[model samples]
Target: MADVDQVRPRQAASPSMTARQRLALGLLLSAGFTLAVDFSILNVALPGIGADVGLPLDGLQWVATAFALCAAGFTLLFGRLADMFGRRRLFLAGMALLGVASAAGGLATSPAALVGARAAQGLATAAVTPAALALLTTSFPEGPHRDRALGLNGALMAAGFTAGAILGGVLTDLLSWRWAFFVNVPVAAAVVAIAPAVLAPDRLGRRPRLDVPGAVTVTAGLLAVVYGLTAAGDTSWGDPRTVAALAAGGVLLAAFWVIESQVAAPLVPVTVLRRPGVRWGNVAGLTAFATETSLVFLLTLYLQKVLGYSPLVAGLSFTVLGAGTVLGGIAGPKVIGRIGGRSAMVAGFAVQAAATLTLVRLGPEPSWTALLLVATFAGGVANLVAIVGFMVTATSGLPDREQGLATGLATMSQQVGITMGIPIMSAVVTARVHGLGGQGPGAVLGGITTAIVVNAAVCAAMAIVAAVFPRREALTQVPPAAPPGT
Candidate 1:
C-alpha cells in the first residue's frame, strides 16, 4: 500500500485565485447548503406528505429513516470513490442523481415510490457531500484562507436547516408539500450546469482500487444499526427485530474491522483512525451534532405542542438562531486563530451546554418570545462555532489523497449523531411521559423538561471531553512519508 504522502500532490493552492475559482467555491457552498436544506425541508412536510399519500404513521417514519440510513451507510464508500475517480466527476454525477430523485419524489403517487426516491436522494447526497468538502479543502491553502472559507461554508449549511424548516412550513401551507421536494430540482440543475466549467478535476497518480468486502460490510452494518435505532424508538429495544438487527450490525462491523486489517487497500485505512485529529474531531462532532439537534427537536415540540404556537410562528421564532449562527460563522475563524481549535471547540460546547440548560425553564405556559428565543440564539452561535472547529480540526493536515476520507468521517459522525440522538431522546421523553401517567399539558412539560435536562448534562460532559482535545499542531501533523523510492 502506498503512503498518503506518496499519493498526494506537493503543490499548494496560491493565496490569490482567479474569478472562476471563486465561482467554484460558491457552487460548492451552494451544493452543501442544498444538501442541508433537503434534509430538514421534509421535517415539517411529513404530516402533509402522510396525508397526501395515505401513509400510515409507521411508514411515514421510514421516509426520514430510509434517507438517514442510506446517507450514513454509503457516505464513506462514495468518499473513497471520489478520491479514486475524480471529485468533480462524482460531484456532477451526484448532483444529476439528486435532481432526478427530487423530481421523482415530487411526482410520487405511492408511498413506496416516495420513500424509494428519498433513499435515492440520500445516496446521491452521500456522494456529493464529502466530494464537495474535499474540493473546498483542496481549492484553498491551509491557513486563514481555508479557515474563512470553511467558516462561511459551515454558516451557510447551518442556515440551510433553519431556512428549510421555515420554507417547508410555508410551502406546505401555501401551495403543497410536494413543492418542498420540487424546490431542490432547480438548484441542483443549476449546480450541474455550472460545476463543470468552474471546478477543476482531481488528478490521480495511480489507478485506484476498491475494498469491496470492507465497503459491503461497513455499509450493511451502518444500515442495520440505523434501522435498529429507528425501530427501537417506535417499538422497544427488546423487540425481536430491533435486537436481531443490532446484534447483526455489531457482528458485521467486527467483520469489517478484520477485513480492513487484511485488505491491501482498505476502504477506511487504520492509519486514518490512528490520527489524533481524526479521532477526537469525530468524537466532538458527534457530541455537538447529537446534543444540538436533540435540543432543537425537543424545543420544537415544546413550542408547537405545549405552547400551541402555529407552525409559521414556530418557524419564524428561529430567526434569532439563524442570525446568531451566521454571526458566529463570520467570527469563527478569528476566534479559532486566537484561542486555537481545541479551545474554540471546548468553548463552543460550553456555550451549547449552557443554552440547553436554559431551555429547562420551559413550562406548560411560558413566554415564547423572550427567554426561549434568547436560548435558541446562543445555541445557534455555539453550533456554528462547534461545527467549524470540528471540521477544521478533523480535516486539517490531511494529505490531498485523504481529504475525502477525513471529510467523510466527519460528515458520517454528524449524520450518526443526528440519527441516534432523535430516537434515543424521543425514547427518553416517551418513557418519562409514560412514567408520569398523566394525560395533561403539565405532564408533557414535565417530560420535556426532564429529557432536556438530561441533554444538558450530556452536553456538559461533551464539553469536558472537548477540553481535553489534543493541541492544534499535534492534531494537524502530517503522516510520515514512504521510503525514498517507492
Candidate 2:
C-alpha cells in the first residue's frame, strides 16, 4: 500500500523557498484575491445586478449566497482532484474557468444566466482554493519553512479580503457594477500565464479512478444542505421541499462517510478528525465564519436598505472590517505566542461577543458616523481575532505530509461556514421581518443581531476547545490579530 511517504522531502536553499514554491505561492495568492474580494464587493453590485435582471429582493440573496454554496460544495472534491491529478494544472485551469465565468456573468442579459455563471465561477473558485493551498504545502518542505509560508499565505488572504472591499467599492463607484466582474479578467489572465512556470506538478499516481458515484452522492448531499438552508428562510419550517432536501443531504453525507471509509485515499480521512486540535480548530472556524459572513450580509443590507447608502458606500463600509481582519491576521502570531492560542481565542471571542451584543441593543436610527465607526473598527477587530485564532488551531497537529490536505480541509470548512451561515441568517432575518410594516428594518436588524450573538457564543465555545491544544505552551508566547499584510 502506498502511503503519503512515497513523496520525498522537496526543499530549496537560502530562503528555503524552492523557486517553484515561490512562484506557486505567488500565483496562488493572486488567484486567491478574487475570492476574497468577491465576498465583500459583489454585495455592492448586487442591487445593480438585481435592478438590471429584475430579480425580486429575496431572490437577490441567492446571488451572493449561492456562490458560497457552490464553492463550498465542490472544494473537497476539487481538493482531492488536485491530490490525484496535478495541483498546478488544476489551479491554472480553475483560474481560467473563473475568468470565463466572471466574464459570462458580467455580460449576462438575465438573472438566471448571471446566477448560472456565478455558480460556475464558484465551482472554479473551489478548485483553485484547495489546489493552490495544497500545491504550496507540498512545494514547501515541513518545519519553520512551511510555517512561515503558511503564515504569509494567511496574511495575503487576509489582505486580499480587505483590499477587495476597497477596490470593489472604488470600481463599482467609478464604473458600472459590471466592472467588479470585469476586474478579474486581467488578474486571472496574469495568473494563468505566470502560474505554470512556478507551480509544482500534481501529486498523481496511476491509482484507480476517483469514486464517481461517491463523489456525486456527496456533492448532491451537500448541494441539498445548502439548498435547504437557503430555502428555509423564505419558507415554513415544515416546508416539504426544505425537509426533503435536509433529509436527503443527511443521508447522502452518511453514505459518503461509508464509501470513504472503505476507499484507499479517502476525501476526508476519518482518523484526522479524531485529533483534538484539528477538530476544535474546524469547529471554531465554522462558527466564527458563520458569524462574520452573516454580519457582512446583514451589514450590507442595513447600509443599503436602512441607511440608504449607495452600493459604493456600503462597500466602503466593509473596508473597515477588512482592515480589522488584516490587523488581526498580522497580530495573530504574536498574540498566540503571548497569550496562547486558547487564551487568544477566548479573549478574541469575548471582544467580538461584546461588540455584537452591543449592536443588538443599539437603536436602528443611529447616525452614519456611529454605525460606520462600529462596523469598521469593531468588525475588523472581531474578524481578525476570531479567524487567526481559529486557523492556528486548525493547523496544529496533523503530520507534515498531510499538511496540504489539512489545509485544504480547513479552507473548505471556511467556505462551508460561508455557505451555511448566509442562508441561515438571511432566513432568520426574513422570518423576523416577515410581518413588520414600519418596523421591517428593526426586525431584520434583530435577526442579524441574533445571528451575530449566536456567532459570539460559538466562538466562546471554540475557545474552550482551543484551550486544550497541544501547542498551548508556544501559543502563549504569541499574540493574535495584529494586522494582516504588515
Poorest stretch of ten by lDDT in candidate 2? 1-10
Off by over 4 Å in 1: 1-18, 366-368, 469-486
Candidate with best lDDT: 1
Number of clashes recorded per candidate: 0, 33
Tens digits of lDDT, candidate 2, 180-253: 78888888889988776666445555744677767787788888887777677557557898899889999999
Candidate 1 per-residue lDDT, tens place, 457-478, comes to 8878877876654544343574
For each candidate in turn, the TM-score is: 0.92, 0.82
Clashes of 2: 33
Local distance difference test, candidate 1: 0.83
